[model samples]
Target chain A: MSKYVMKNLSDIEIIESVKRGNTADYTMIVDRYKDRAFNLLKRMLKNDMDAEEALQDSFLKAFRYLNQFREEASFSTWFYRIVYNTALSVIASKKRKIEKEMTSLEDMPELISYDREIYATVENPKDYLMRLIDKLPIKNALVLILYYIDGLSLNEISLVMDISLVNAKVLLHRSRNILRDLLLKHNYQEEIL
Target chain B: MNIDELLNDYIDGSINANKINELKELLEKDEMTAKKLKALKAIDVLMRTIDYEKAPRDFSEKFAAYLAKNRVIKKDRKDFVTPTVLSLFMVVMLCILAVSFYYSYLSINDTEMISGILLDIFNGVSFIAGNKLFHLLGASVSFIALTILYIMNETHRRFRKKIKDL
Candidate 1:
C-alpha cells in the first residue's frame, strides 16, 4: 500500500501546501482518501446516489475550507469528520424533503445486497433484522458502523464524530446490544450456536 | 463487565485478554451468557464476511470537479479582503491626519501659520502612509505569524458551529 493510502501526510504538510496554492497536492489527498470516504459515506447514507452526491459535496467543502484544517489531528481523520457530517446533513435533508414517501430498503441499491444477506440469515427476514437496524437512530447506526465495520477505535470515532470518548463507547455498546436483541428476536439462532 | 459492553469490545478485539478469559469462564458456567456470546460472534463473522463495496466509478471525477469549483469560490472570497484592507488603511490615514492637525495647532508659531499647516498636513500624510506601508510589508514578511492567528480564530469559530450543528 502507498504511504499516502496507509498513513496520511501530516496536517502541517497539507496546510502548508494548501497555503502555497499548490492545489495539486490536494489531488493526492483526494486520491488517497476517496475510497475510504466513499465507503464510509455509502454506509452512512445507505443509498448509492445520495452517498455519491454527499461525498462530492463533502470533498468540495473540505477543499474549500482546507485552510481551516488545524494541525491538531491527522489529515485523513479530519477529512473523514467532514465526510461524516456532510453525509448526516444530506440524509437529514433528504428525510425532510421526502416525509411521506415509504422508505423501502430496495430504494437504496447499495444497501440491497446487505439487506439480502440479513434477510437470508434470519427467520423474520425483512421485518425483524433489516428493519431494526434501519430504524435505529442515525447516531446509533453511525456509531455501530464506525466501530464495527470501519474498525476505528473508540477514541478515533470520538474524534471523527466529535463526541466524548465515553459517549462513543457507550453508543457502540448500546448499538451492539440492540443488534444482538434484534437478531435474537428474528430467530437467527442457527448462526449463534 | 456486562454482556453488552463486552460484546462491542469482544467484536472489535479491544477487550483485554483478562476480560476475555473471565468472560470465557463465565460462559462456561452460564448457558445464557454463552448463548449471547455465541450470537455476537456469529454476527461479527457475518459482518466481516460481507463485502465492503467501493464507491461508484465516476466518484473521483465528480469529486474533482466539485473540489475545483469550491476552490475557485474560496480563492475569490480570500482575495475579496484586499479591498477591505485598503479601506482600513484609509481609516488609519485619516486618524493620523486628525492627530497631526491637533498637534500642529499647539506647536506652530503665529507668523508661520499657513506654511505650518501645509507642512503639518504633508508630514502627517507621509508619516501615516509610511507607517502603514511598513506595517503591511512587515505583515507580508512574517505572513505565517498573523495569518496563522487569524486562521486559527476563524477555524475555532467554524469548529464550534460544526459541533453545534451536530
Candidate 2:
C-alpha cells in the first residue's frame, strides 16, 4: 500500500492487522512514525548515523515484539518509549566509544555550525527573540520544541519525556527563564510587550 | 508564594483568577517584576516561532529493512518449543510407547517367567495411567505418575508466571 493510505489507518486497526500476521501493516506504522521518531532520536543522540541506526533497531525490536503489546497505552506512546530507549542505548554506546577513543571536546568535530544568514535575518524584533531561544541547554531545547514547535501541552510533554506533571512545568518555566536571560545578554532592546 | 513562582504559574496559565489579580497588582507596582514578565513572554513567543530540523527522507525505509532482518532472526529462534509444551509432548509420547511395547511383549513371550515380567509391566503402566488416589495407595505406577505430575505442575506454574509478566 502507498504510504499515504497506510498513514491514514487508525493505530488500533494496524495493530490488529499486525497480530493477524500482516507484516505489511507494520510497514505502515514505520512509515507514519519514522520521521518523527528519527527526529527525536537525532536530537537526543546528536549524531546522524547513530540516530539512523538506532531508529532502525528500535523499529525492528518493536515489530518483533508486536505480540507482546498490551494496548493499555496509546500505540504512539508505547512506540515512542521504545524509540527513546533505543536512542538512549545509542547514546550510551557512543559514550563508550568516546571513552575508548580518549578524545577531548577540542578534538571532536563540531556538529552545530552557526549560520551567518540566520544571524543576519534577525532584522526584526521577533527574529531576535527566536535567536535567543536557540541558545538554551539541550534538555530545555527539547522541552521547548515539544511544547511550542510540536504544540503539545505540558501534560503531553510529561508523558513523552516520562516525567511528572510538576517536573514538566518546572522545566518549562526554567527553560523560559534561561531564554529570557539569553535575550537580555544579547542586549535585545525590543519592547517585549 | 513568591513573585517568581507567581510569574511562572501565570505564564503557564496554571494560576487561578485570585492569583492572577494578585500578580497583576504586583506587576503594576514593581517595575523589575514587570520587566521580568515581559522578557519571559518574549521568550515564550520566540520558542513558539522557532523551527526544528527534520529527519532524513530514507529513515522509514532503512528502519523497515532493519525490522525485517530482526524478525527473521526472532522467527528462527522461536522454532524451539517452550518447556511446558515440550514436557506435555514427551508425556504423551511415553504413554504411547509404553502401550505399544506391552502389546508387543504379550504377543512374543510365552514362558511363565517372561509372562510374569510382562504382567508386571502391564500392571505398572496401568497404575501410572490410573487415578491419583490409586497411585497414592502404593500402586506400581505411583513413582512414574508422581514424577510426571510434578513436571507437569511445575511447567504449568512457570508458564503462568511467564504469561503474567508479559
Candidate 3:
C-alpha cells in the first residue's frame, strides 16, 4: 500500500495493521515520524551521523519490541523514549560530555531593544531562533525545543525525556531565564509594548 | 517571587487575571519587565516558526529495507530463544529430578544399593569418556576454541580496518 494512503490512518490503526501481519505498514509509521524524530535526535546528539545511526537503531529497537508497547501513552512519547535512550547509550559509549559553553561577551549583540515587529520581519526567524537555542545547554535546548517548537505538552515532554513534570517545568523555566539572560547580555532585548 | 518567574508564569498562562494584572502593572512600571516580556514573546514566536528537519529523500526506502532485515533477525532470535530456553529448562528439571531421586534413595537404609548405583553410573560415564567419546569431546572443544579464535582475529582485523578508514 502507498504510504500516502496509510498517512490518514491513526497510529493505533497502523500499529494494529502491523500487528495483524501487514508488516509493510510499519514503514508508514517510520515515514511519518522520520523527519520529526531526526530533528530531535539531531539536536540531542548534535552530530548528523550519530543522530542518523541512533535514529535508525531506535526505530529498529522500537519495532523489535513493538509488542511491549502499552496504549497508556501516545506512540510519539513511546517512540521518543526509545530515541532518547538510544542517543543516550551512544553518548555513554562515546564517554564524552555534551559541553555547554557560556556565550562569550565578545559575541554579544548591542544592548538596544529591537522592535518586536522588526525581529519578526527578519529574513529567517526560525534559523535565527535555532541559532540562539543552539547556544544554550543541551538540557535547556531540548526542553525548549520540545515544548515550544515540537508542541509537546509538559506531561509528554516529561515522558519523552524520562523526567518528572516538576523537573520539566523547572528546566523550561531555567531555559527561558538563560535565553533571556543571553539576550540581555548580547543587548538583543526586544522592545516591549 | 522573582520577575523572571512571574513573567514565565504569565507567558505560560498559568497566572490568573489578578496575577496578570500584577504582571501588567509591573510591565507598565518597570521598563526592564516589559523588555523581558517582549524577549519571551519573541522566543515563543521564533520557536514555533522553526521547521522539522526533512528526512533524506531515500529515507523511507532505506528504512523499509532496514526494517525488513530487522524483522528477519527478530524472527531468527525468537526461533532460537524458545528452543534454547526449553532445552535449558528441561535439563534443569532433569537434574533436579535426579538429585531428588538420589536423596530419596539415601533416605532408605540401603547404603549398598546407593553405592552400587553410583558406582555403576560412574563406571558407565568413565567407560564412555575413556573410549571414542573422550576423543570426540576433545575434538569438538578444540574446534570450538579454533572457531572462537578465528572470530576474534577477524573482529580485531575489522576493528583496525574501521579505525583506519575513519
Candidate 4:
C-alpha cells in the first residue's frame, strides 16, 4: 500500500499487513511512533545520536518480535516498552545511575534551594522548562515525558516503566513538584501566564 | 483529604463541588498552600502545552532502509525440527551398526530377519572399516557434517551480533 493510504490504517491493521509479509508497511508503524518515542528517549538519554540509535534498535526489536505482540494490548504501549527499555539499557551502558528510588507519594524529598541564576541562562521559556525537566532522575524524567509530552495515561506509563500505577503517579507528581520549585525559585511566576 | 491532595484533585478537575468550595476556602486563608498551587498550575500549563521534540527527519526512511538491508530471517521452531529429526536418524543408524557389530563379532545372531539385516550391515561396516577408499569417504563425510554444523553456529552468532551492533 502507498504511504498515504497506509497512514489511515490502524496500528493493528498495519501490524497485520506486516505480519502477512508486507514488510514495507512497517514504515507506518515506525513513522507513527518515531517522534514521540524519540522524545522519551532523547529526554532520558539527553543526546540525539544515542536516542536515534536506541530508536533504531527499538524498531528492529519490535519488528523482530512483532509476532510475539499480543493483540489485546495497544501497540503504542508495547512499542513504548521497547523504547523505554532500550533507553534504560543505553543509560546502563554509560554507567550513569538512575536517580530517585523513592516509590511512594509520601516519600518526596525535602525541598532544596535552587539557583535562580541557573534558570536565567535560557531566554526561551520552553527550553528553560525542558532544561528543568531534564534535571530530573531518569525514570522520573521518563514518566513526565510520557505523561505531559506523549499524553500517555498513568496506567500506560506504569506499564511502560514496569512500575506500579501509584509509583508512576508518584514519579510524575514528584517531578512536577521539583520543576515547580525550580520555576518558582527562578521567579518565572509572573511570566508563566 | 488534606490540602495538597485537595489541591491536586482541584487541579485535575477531579474534585466534587463540596471539595472545590473547601479548597477555595483554604486558598483564601492559606498563603503557602496557595503558592504551591500556583507553581503546580504553572507546571501543568507548560507541560500540557509544550511541543514534543521531534526525532530527526527521515527517521522512518532510514529505518526502512535498514530493515530492507538486513532481511532478518526469523528463528522458528521449524528450523530446529529438521536438525532434531536428522539427529534421531543418526542415532537409529548408530544403534543398527552396534547390533550388526555385536552379531558379526560376538556371534550372537538368532532371528532370520536380524541375520539377513546384519549380513548387509556387516558388509558395509567391514567395507568401510577395512578398505582405505571407503574409510577416506567416511572421514570426508564426517568432516563435511562437522563443518556444516560449525558454520550454522557461527552464522547464528554473527546474526545476533549484527542486530546488536546496529
Candidate 5:
C-alpha cells in the first residue's frame, strides 16, 4: 500500500490488517512511533545503540501482545507505556541510578551553573537548551520530551510514565523552570525574546 | 497568584483576557517578571521546536523484514497448526509405506495391485463393521485419542512459544 493509504488507516485498522495476514501493514505502526519513542529512549538511556535496541524490543513486545490490546485505551498511549517501561529496563540493566521521584523539590528548579565547556561546543541557544534538558533528571527530561516534542498532555504523560498527574505537572514545571534559569544565567534570554 | 504561576498560565494559553492584561501589566512594571517571561518563552519555543531524533532510516522496514523472517502472522496459532499437520502427514506417509511393502511381498504387479489392495481393504473394513457395538466403541476411542493428541500438541506449542518469546 502507498504511504498515504497506510497513514490514513487507524491504529485499529492497521492492527486488524496485521491479524488478517497483511503482516507488512505492521511497518506502518513501526514507522508511526519509532522516531518519537527513539527520542525518548535516547534521552533516558543516553546511548544510541541501547536506545535503538530498546526501541526494537518495545515494538517487538507490542506486536507480540497486540491481541491483548483493549479498544478503550488509545493505541498511542498503550504503545508509549510499553516504550517507557522498556527504557526503564534498559536503564536498570545498565545499573544506572534512576533519579527517584522526589515527593517535593524543596529547592525547586535548583540546577547547577551552566557548564562553560558545554557552552563553548554548541552553536546556538536551541542546542544549548537541548543539552540542558539532556542533563535534567530522567523523569524531568521525559516529561519535557513527551509534552513538547511528542505533543502529549500532562495527563497522557502521567499515564505513560505511571506517575500521578501532580507528579507529571511538577516534573514538567520544574524542568522548564530549570531550563529557563540556565538560559537567563547564560544571557540567552535576549535571543529567546 | 504568584508571577511564576501567572506566567505559566499565560504560556500554556490558560490565562483569561483579564489575566492576560494583568500579566502584561506585571511584565511591564517588574524587570524580574519581564526577564522571567522572556526566558520562559524562549525555553518553550526551543522545546516545541526540538527535533525528534531520527531512528535509523530503515527502522520500520527492518522491523517488517524481521516479522517476515519469523513468520509472525498470528504465529501462536500457526505454531500449533503447523506441528500438528506435519505430524499427521508423517503418520499417513508411514501407513502408505507399510501398505506398499505388504503388496510387494504378495507378488502383485502394478496392474493387479490396485484392485487387490482395494478389495483387501474393503474386506478388512467390512469384517470390523460387521460388529456394530465394536464399530461404535472403536469410533469413540478414535475420537478420544485424536482429542488428546490435539490437546497435548497445543500445550507443547504454547510452552515452546513462551520460551521463544522470553
Candidate 6:
C-alpha cells in the first residue's frame, strides 16, 4: 500500500502493524519524519553524511524497540528524543565540545540606523535567519530549531532535549539574545527588522 | 521582570493583561527596552520562515528493502519461540524432578538408605583420587596451558616478522 493511505493511520496503528510482524509497514514511519529528523541531525552534526547515517541508525533503533513504546507521550516526541540522543552520542564520540559563546555588548554598534531601501532589497528574512542560526552556538541553534521550526511546546522541547523546562526556556531566551547580537554585529539589526 | 523575560512572554503571547500593562510601562519608561522588544519581535518573525527538508525520493523504498533483509535474519534466529519452548521444557522437567524426589524421600522411611548413598559417593571420589586420576587431570591442564603460551608466542613472532617484511 502507498504511504499516503497509511498516512491516515495513527502512530499507535503503525506501531501495532510493526508489532504484528508487518515489518514492512515501518517504512511509513520512516517516510513520514525522515526529513525533519534529518534536518535536526544535520544541524547537530554539522555534516551531511553523518546526519544521514544517524537518521538511518535512529530509525532502525526505534523499530527494534517499538515494543517498548507506551502512549505516555506522542510518538513524534519519543522518536525525536531518540534522534536527539543519537546525534549527541555521535558528537560525543568525536570529542566535540559545543560551547555557547555569548557575544558581548561591546561588539554591537553604538548607533542603530535604519534605511527603507535595505529592508526592501532583503528578499527573504527566513532564509537570512537560517544563515544566522547556522552561526549560533550548537545549543542555541537546537533550541531555536526545536521551538520555532519544529513547533514544539516548551514541555516537549524539554523532553526532547532531556533538560528541565526552566532550562529550555532559558536556552530559548539566550538564543534570541545571541541572534540579536549577531544581527547587530553584522549591522542588520535595523534593516532586517 | 527582566527585558529578556518580558520580551519572551510578549512573543509567546503568554502575558496576561497585567503583565502586558507592566511591559508597556517599561517600554515607555526606557528606550532601550522598547528597541529590544522590536528587535526580538522581528527575530521571531524571521524564525517562522525556517522550512523542513524533503525526504529523498527513494528513502521509503530503500528503507523498506532494509527492513526486508532484517526480517530474513530475524526469521532465521527464531529467538522468541526457541527460548520460550526451552524455558517451558526446563520448568516442567524441574517440577517432575522435585515431585519424584519428594516421593522417594517419603518412601525411604529409614535413615540407613540415605547414609549408604552418601558413603557410596565418598568411596567413589576416594577411588578416583587413589588411582591418580586427579594427577592426570592436573597434568592435562598444564599441557594445555603450555600449548596456549607457545601458540601465543609464535603468533606474536610471526606478526612482528610480517610487519618488518612490510
Q: DockQ for each of the predicted structures, in order?
A: 0.21, 0.26, 0.26, 0.29, 0.39, 0.25
lDDT of 3 by residue, B53-160 (tens): 776778888877876675543331234786899999999999999999899876878888878989999998899888997889989999999999999989998996
In the order shown, what is each candidate's alpha-carbon RMSD? 11.1, 8.9, 15.7, 12.9, 8.5, 16.1
> What is the per-residue lDDT of model 4 for residues B111-132, given as tens digits with 9 covering 90 to 100?
8767787799999888778899
lDDT tens readout by residue for model 3, A83-175 = 878877888899968654333223333312332334455555455457656555567778887887678999999999888998888888877
Global lDDT of each candidate: 0.68, 0.69, 0.75, 0.79, 0.82, 0.78
True contacts kept of 6: 0.65
* Model 5 lDDT tens row, A1-100: 7878877999999988886667667888998899999999999999999988999899999988886777788899999999999998888888889985
True contacts kept of 4: 0.66
Which candidate ranks first by TM-score, i.e. highest? 5
lDDT of 4 by residue, A71-115 (tens): 898999999999988988998899988776544324443323223
DockQ of 5: 0.39
TM-score of chain B of each: 0.35, 0.47, 0.42, 0.42, 0.43, 0.42
Clashing pairs in 3: A111-A187
Please give the range of 10 consecutive residues that has the lowest summed lDDT in model 2 chain B: B71-80
Ranking by DockQ: 5, 4, 2, 3, 6, 1
The candidate that wins on lDDT is 5
Q: Which lDDT value does model 1 have at B59? A: 69
- Candidate 5's residue-wise lDDT over B39-149, tens digit each? 988888878888899999988877777767786655434347778999999999999999999977777667677788889999988888898988799999999999999
TM-score between candidate 5 chain A and the true chain A: 0.90
Count of backbone clashes, every candidate in sequence: 0, 0, 1, 0, 0, 0
Cα deviation of A137, candidate 6, in Å? 2.0
Per-model TM-score of chain A alone? Answer: 0.69, 0.71, 0.81, 0.89, 0.90, 0.82
lDDT, candidate 3, at A178: 62
TM-score of 6: 0.67
Off by over 4 Å in 3: A1-5, A98-125, A186-193, B70-166
Backbone clash tally (model 6): 0
